[model samples]
Target chain A: MESPSKTYQPTSTPFDVDAIRRDFPILERKVLGKPLVYLDNAATTQKPSAVIQSITDYYTQINSNVHRGVHHLSEEATNAYEGAREKVRQFLNAGSVEEIIFTKGTTGGINLVASAWGRKHLKAGDEVLVSGMEHHSNIVPWQMICSEKGAHLKVIPINQQGELDMDQYTSLLNERTRLVALVHISNALGSINPVRRMIEMAHRKDIPVLIDGAQAAPHLAIDVRDLDCDFYAFSGHKMYGPTGIGGLFVKKAWLEKMDPYQGGGEMIKSVTFEKTVYHDLPHRFEAGTPNIAGAIGLGAAIDYLRAIGYDSILAYESDLQAYASEKIGSIPGVRLIGTAHDKAGVVSFVVEQVHPLDLGTMLNAAGIAIRTGHHCAQPVMDFYRIPGTARASLGIYNTRAEIDHLAETTRETIKLLS
Target chain B: MNSTKVAENSIQAAQDSIIEDFELLEDWTEKYKYIIELGQVSPGLPEALKTPDIKIKGCQSNVWLHTELKDGKIVFSGDSDAMITKGLINLLINVLSDREPREILEGDLYFIDRIGMKQHLSPTRANGLASMIKQMKIYALAYKTKLENAN
Candidate 1:
């Protein structure tokens, strides 16, 4: 495997990180009397002022139930809510607005497909393929549905560098393979899977694919149509939007055929004691009162990302990741966990004789927040034969100086613990 | 003093000394350094005793605690993968170990709070500090039952 630093040449384009940092209000706050250096982006990103204000505006101005009432407030609420759907549709470059279904987050989206699609299509002895690097969200839903359907859940193994074994993945694809669900970018190892090629491989076998884009959506520009995935799920919170609201982008063909995930008022076109008619594409999947403000906030988040552009985000973050890997890995006992050729800005490592939880606590005292433990990827931990790792995931707002501090503090903490 | 009173006084005395030691530390780093040193010197449970049955749940790191009744007193030994968690386990053992079941069950450990380690006791922290304390008392309750039955 090639070193990640050498794989991507750092762009010479200037990135205004200081100006970007000012956009997040929470960045001004200090932790433990020290200025905060938040590196837990893979868990959740800090919301910009625009996203925060959008949520505030929704409650303060509109504050009405959507798609039900005929009053002026309802009309405004309906437009804003539906407008957010349009924003998501454009964000993923999906074929139509009907493809975007509002969900609780990535977990909700995966569960929706695993229930609605899996229950309808899967048969006994059928197999669902998922990568070893998947977050628990991507793995458990399939496990539940597969067990219920008398189907099996098969894992596509990963190599030492945390890259998926492409040959093994191809061999795993067989006649009994019903679906392929994989994470676009690993939250634990920062490995960027060859998802596009993998999708094409599955397509050749007439098997549909679902891409868990929770980690990818914040960093990469997504085009669901280009990827041609059957389903793409992501979280709003991980992409500078409000929590409890996310999207599932299903292909139109699948949406037209799959059953409604839940039955409730908004999901029905007409209801009677004897019979009820389910609503159209997206609304059929979204039941009950939706997260109206959350959707609006996510729309504002999309607008913010579009204004800055993905070109700069990718270049700046890639450079930052490479720099971090070098600096942190230079420490005597520090071992970089993920050395994939292609990766996002997540850097996972473990120090010899120093537990990740101990490292995380010490860093917290210095106001440098990083995620520790198995990172909800226990299978990945088992593969490495270690308990867990200390992960410092980068975001667009982070600076090189923060990485420098992180490296220095990590060195001191390791010495103290050892 | 009677043996039971002696055991109770020793537990309180141990906690007070711990508090005094922590008070001398200047900053968070110094306090943590001292705790790590304590963990290094702590006698860990035997490998055979560190089984899944004794492992504490809800900890980010693995923690194994073993309790045994020796000469009418409960003896506690524990281990953790993380140094800080191990340090905390050592402190807990120091305050509660090698005491009669009734004395162990009735002991109120205030050193963690007095030494500014209250955050570790929060349920959300998931470091197993609170769980370890609860487990030690539970072992005491079980041993107390055994003593009553034997009598």
Candidate 2:
């Protein structure tokens, strides 16, 4: 709970980020012998050497199935794997490790909720509210659940800033609203939701809330206790951990009420030929063999992040985002999307006449990695009435020099395409 | 581009001889043109699949694919918001469907590079193409080898 000093900005942080780029081994490699400048952090962040080593250490030193075995290697693996759970608990500042249930990234976590909670609590004519800015992972699960239960799915609209209209959201929330699942930070547009307020507003109507923290987990500090949302979901890969690992944090009360998501090995306590008793909260949701290596790697990613400090990382990233926005905003025919007052590290844009796919290709040739298209937020695109945008998302490792290169390359690309 | 035409001609020639001899066409050019033509055949996407949930990321054009497997062959029906991309997808469906499980399992997508399309795509579109290819290949791989054996 110790906070880093506000004035303690490190001067050792390079002005020319290229000088500090050596820390990332992947950046050292060339794309066609051109140095790799990765900017697609919103899609997934590249692993640092520390994270890579941590995964290697686990496999080399303690590579056994976790939790079930009573032997030495099994004990070591369980501790290491559960130790990662504790790290996740601390990272999100959740009350207990039991609150964090690992799954196959955000999509799986959301599906777990839909299948488990939606089937049990939701009935025909109930409504599930979502924002226009949600990823498909967040949107489709609710749609599927609604379609099955005959429940309705409603959307909160977005303005030019990409921020959801709170007034409209409030109006949409009636007694029939069963749940409201929203994105904490938009991956397509950099809009950061007022989650604390959103959670409070939904709770007033006795509606349980789920925050899609997939975009927020990497850049911002998450305190579930502070937000007090009923459920939260995030992916490991988006935050510089290994892929195939993510967590769903459910409030203890809600977890108890919901049916088990999947039924398989390790999820059951006692199985007779006639009847089976399910395990307690969290374990009941996590069934079969889990992503042990990925969980351990996620722990390493959290450690690396904590060592650097999230406060400093957030500040540095925010500054860079603002700088890029201002500079990129000045370019002729370049249109910026999602200009919310409070935001995260994503910057989605469109150059006049050039398709995002074409722009992405040209930028890749320049050794820049960017994301293009709807960014899995098709509803957001529909709201804006555009097919998609070219997005450059930042990470802790990104530098201002890269952003400058992005702007310069964007200008050149526009000229070529125009 | 000329080689692509010649390859297409050869594929056509091979097709005329026998369905089994279609594999005799050695290069990607004919395959790519055929792929593009297949895309051209992609039905005008039904307005229904354009729902917020079904949209494919990284595509320059709004493209949607819904697959149904009948008999032994996987039948893909898709549409794109853009004409050229629909053509691109039609090309994809042709290469992706009606292939052996082993061929799909091995995922020899090097054919994309041979056809010169990979070089042309923007990184996002390239990624979309890669993702779409991966999806189709997964269907082929998941085809239960028994299907081929039964046939």
Candidate 3:
């Protein structure tokens, strides 16, 4: 890997963010009659008007099944649906549309691979490597698969600062290692795993890698081709699209080897009384009626992202995150969690004398939205010996002013509680 | 309509119906939804009881409860950011509150099992109810010991 140039500066984004906020009509409204300052982007993002309109437009105009029917509506829906597939291809910069398989979301994608791929390939002595900072979605699926297949699950421990122990991860890789499944970014801690390095290491050992990009896709630029990950999964809702929609990018070679997760109509080529043949690489994985509106919304979300420029969004979010860390972490009794050197726009902290729920309530009263509790990372909480932490995650439309408000409310809360 | 006298008569009748000694109850699934309905009618804790000490750990919302013993009846005050949980606490307090301190100190939480409210709770909520009950019982025991020592 080439070292980042000391003098080199990444290109900065220049978009009218207020105008972008206007694109998301939900931001115009308030929660609990107070102006909603939604900072829970890590949980799910608010959809832009384009994304919302796309869903309405799809159902309003071209609502039909795709890849099978010959009617005009089906044709239009097929084009629009496949068009969204192309958008997803461009969104992740994957090699081909054939590589993108739509699923319910990241959870569905991981489960699909685990049930179809892990179940077939893994044996009693095989091991699946995952990081300590994984969400329950990432961890539980593998654990379930491993337990059923009689395979062992190995965890790559994090340091005190919540960064993965790369040395330990490398040591854990050996002959019995069937796969290395890791999150590209920690949802709870916002720690960016070194995917390129991890992928390369796993490749050398001939073990396939699956990168959980649910957190990363929302906050960063992801090119599965560039990363060379065997499988990458992310949710559209986290990327400003609607819920119940997402995709898994499986390498063509691997998809050919893996069996279909579900057996249904579209996934079949020709069904006979005695025998049935499966469809091609991507189609084989996508069975049943798809989320046509959701796929359209996801495409529009990608457009919204592209219009603002992914690099610029990442840069601006990174800046806001750093500013938030400095301002919020400076408050007395507030200890920041997930202090990885490479982090996304997420700040998680715990106050010395206040439970995260109390902090969340006070923040809610102030009209500032933040996530409280384990954030679906119970093992991480158990590791730290704390119940949970309050998290405020930033998005492309978020501003420094919101961070200031978050800090101010947090400070005021500590004072009040004390 | 003599409603006050009727209410007193009903209270006397309810008292008359009380069981002697603790009785182990069966799985209370038949009454589960009603207990949940009871949770619906449960009121919010007083604003004064919202404090850091009584906060239920691991919940997504803030929940606080304070209990007091006066005239041999336990009284509870509690509140929460979330509505259903507040209602749940209210239901819990309504049953356990106003009970004899000796009964509370006896560590017989079988009525909760009898009611089978834990079945409806998420694992987190169930654990939280356990902790709250645990704290309440501990508080009652401490008070009982103090009363005994004072005598």
Candidate 4:
């Protein structure tokens, strides 16, 4: 008898997905008396044993506050923390380590930029341009800053296929446009935006751009210098790293001019009754004692990804995405929401007369985890006039058989509900 | 006994019957299938009554609940876009609807727990089962106060 969870072998590829699955311990676990089929990678990826071990090693061996103490343990802790920043710098191909600022997550990174940069530059009637497919994290921060500064928040619309209207995006760029913030990939729709071209368009107008790479960093190889995006924000957890640790990449020029994000211990050079001078580039924004263990864990995650290489990851995922799109789209009453030409390994669909919540609950009973909701992209949902979508986002560890199981169960669920 | 006392006893009896029915089901699929059947058979709230004012917030699916004081009992009519949520709503309506406001206000819904559907009652469950129960109790409290004012 053939195993239901048999690994799908790709012809003549060095990408051994079965071997990769062993790195993630959670994949071996069971949910609801069935093998767990995790399809919620867009929400957060499962951590590898290497990443977990790095975090454990930090707490067990090198546990101390960074930068302040003259003690040996402090130096070791600071080295590990700063080492993680260097790893992130390499991961994004950022010019310097000074360009990386540790943040709480993608939300925190965007909020920092909105507070620090927008507060200084934005004036009344100025506009911040964002796409309709942006996550709430990318949209809300700009809205908050815009409302405060009396600036306008303009949206570049997306078509029914979930691709951004590049013509409208170009027109939206004008003298009033202070900054353009865009998502590299839409989390809800799975559409990978042409960010490189968009960044060039913004640059042509001499307007700075911020790319929310929260979804992109996990799947794509980021080259900050090549893209030339002024600001790039990504969460570590999305890329199989620890929660509460992420990186924000700002150009050196902007970092030098922007105001400090927060005022506290690590951010300051010296503090007195009078005025206090802030620290250099990245440290000025760090403020408090950061997530030291999380940073170390993220470093390990970066190392693990580099070992597998992005070329193999992208190729394998493209195949998986194609398989999922074909198999899932063929189901009756299941309409694929985002039919963009370019997409990540994510399938967002809605079944006729079957709400996403119902489908999600039924799938959970079968031990298949998926994300169901507006995916924090309410504007995208509003554009499509859907309540939500049942999203199955793939990770590097996912198999073709798992996708087959998903499609089969989804068909059964729809039948049972109908 | 008074009518309110009889209504409370009926609510308990209805919950026991639901628990007994659920216990006979083999697994989650069977249990939810039964719920789905109940949802299919249950009458929907009139489209005119599904206004934003009556819609319950925080539910992943759109759910609208309408309540009225008919005679001495509070009647609830609710509907949800999701079948499972609608089924849960129908179950609640069965146990608590068409009962005296006093009975509804005091009735503890233990059937959801006894039937292995305790997850629905969790505050974080996007179905908003807990919120629906709370909203129903709020309606009962308001109707009870109205009765007192009228007397």
DockQ for the candidate 4 complex?
0.65
What residue pairs are clashing in model 4? Answer: none
> For residues A220-301, what per-residue lDDT tens digits would candidate 2 score against the true structure?
9999999999899999999888999998898888887889967898798999999999987678787897888889888888
Clashes of each: 0, 9, 1, 0
Per-residue error (Å), model 2, residue A291: 0.7
Q: What is the docking quality class of candidate 1?
A: medium
Instruction: Compose the digit string of candidate 4's lDDT tens values, residues A1-418.
Output: 2221112222223589988898899999988677999999999999988888787777778789999899988988898889889889999999999999999889999999999999999999999999999999999999999999999999999999999998999899999999999999989988999999999999999999999999999899999999999999999999999999999999999998799968998999988989899988799999999999888888888888877888989999999999999999999999999999999968999999898878888888778999988999988888999878999999999999999999998999889888
How big is the positional error of residue B91 in model 2, measured in Å on the Cα after superposition? 17
lDDT of 1: 0.89
Best first by DockQ, ranked: 4, 1, 3, 2
Per-residue accuracy of model 1 over A1-418 as CA lDDT, tens digit each: 2211111111222367887888888999987678999999999999988788788777877889999899988988898899999989999999899999999999999999999999999999999999999999999999999999999999999999999999999999999999999999999999999899999999999999999999999999999988999999999999999999999999999998799978997999999999989998789999999999999888888888877789988998999999999999899999999899998979999999888878988888788999988999999999999888999999999999999999999999987876
lDDT of 3 by residue, A1-418 (tens): 1211011111223566787777778889875556889999999999877777777777777778888788877888888888889888988899999999999999999999998898789999899999899999988999999999899999999987999998899899999999999999898898998999999999999999999999999888899999999999999999998999999999988887899879988899999999999998798898898888888888888877876777788877888889999999999999999899999968998899776755676677567889989999999998888889999998988988888988998897677555
lDDT for each residue of candidate 3 in B101-140, tens digit (9 for 90 to 100): 7766653444444443545354766787777777677777
Using Cα atoms, each model's DockQ against the true complex is: 0.59, 0.06, 0.07, 0.65
Residue A270 displacement (Å), model 4: 1.8
The true-versus-predicted C-alpha distance at residue B62 of model 1, in Å, is 3.2
On the 0 to 100 scale, the lDDT of residue A151 in model 4 is: 100
CA lDDT of each candidate? 0.89, 0.78, 0.79, 0.89
Clashing pairs in 1: none
Which 10-residue window of candidate 3 chain A scores lowest in summed lDDT?
A: A1-10
